[model samples]
Target: MTASPADAEAPLSAHHRKKQPEQVRRALLDCAAQIAAEQGASAITIQAVADRAGVTKGGLLHHFDSKQALLAAVFADLLEQMDREIDRTMAIDPVSRGRFTRAYVRACFSDRLLGERSLWGALSVAIVSEPALRSLWSGWLDSRMAQHAETDGDPRLVAVRLAADGIWLADMMEKAGGLKRYPQDFERVLLAMAEG
Candidate 1:
């Protein structure tokens, strides 16, 4: 038999031949997040995400039933990432009393959640305007609070978390407005509160 150009090429691997469902879903989510970060949540349309992910609209719809569902999933994914980051930060703390609160404070200051160009900043407006997204956020916060009821129940620690929330909002606003409204030591003050 004569060898042809096709015979010289290696066979395609299973990975190349077939796309895993999880991989496709993750790609869609990442594309949605990127679009939101760049152009705000309003830009996360089905066609946009599908096109960005290199998947057909039907493929994207297979993972998410609707645009609202996709947005919810993206919001949930961000919260899950934040939760993991908080857990990682908490693991390094030697103190157990306010460890969770301290981790939350650190996470609030982390780049993942801060700045206008970040996913959280881009989604903040949607979180406020969309009830579904807001509810998901509130549920996540409530679950975390309940989970750490024993270790982070101190009123002072709660105050620290509240302060961290303010700091995060202020930082987002500052970046969005191109102004410096918060003091340079705001994070330091919040961390100090977490220590108590």
Candidate 2:
């Protein structure tokens, strides 16, 4: 048998083929998220996601059994990313009440998290399907609120927390002019609350 020029590319092709499955799954999630961002949750179906991901429907199903599973995976990925960010922030800053709160608020309002429509849809699906997850989310927020209350006796901390949450909710809902209609002035309000 004689070797040809195509043989030289065989190794690279094999490497790509080996890694392509994971890449496809990632692409599916990313594309689905983008579609959800632009068109809303109704656009995030298995067929649409698979088509967007450029994979066969069978391939997508192998990664996610159902739409709910896909949504849960998305939420899990978002939370895991948040945890990594929180860990990084903690490593850089001393663990003070104010520092912790400020870092958290900064992280929440950071570009990575702001106006993340996919995460909101995923969170909504997860919350509806998994009550425990809802409790967990609520518990985390409540704990943070309690911590702020302990550090700052002002009732305004609750309002500040709620205001921050309102920002998130508005972003999630995709309500027109939400941010402009109820601007929270995050930096100014958060600093006053956390500094106290």
Top candidate, metric lDDT: 1
Q: Give the lowest summed-lDDT range of ten residues in model 2.
A: 112-121
Model 2 ranges off by over 4 Å? 1-20, 111-160, 170-174
Across 1-196, the per-residue lDDT of candidate 1 in tens digits comes to: 8878886696876457766899989999999999998888899999999999998899899999999999999999999999999999888899998888888877776763346668887887788789999899899999999999999998999988887777666655566442256654666788887775
Q: What's the C-alpha lDDT at position 85 in model 2?
A: 79
Candidate 1 regions exceeding 4 Å error are 1-17, 112-114, 171-174, 177-179
CA-lDDT, candidates in order: 0.84, 0.64
Q: Least accurate stretch of 10 residues (summed lDDT) in model 1? A: 176-185
lDDT of 2 by residue, 102-171 (tens): 6566565664234445455435544655765566677666665565565533556555556666666665
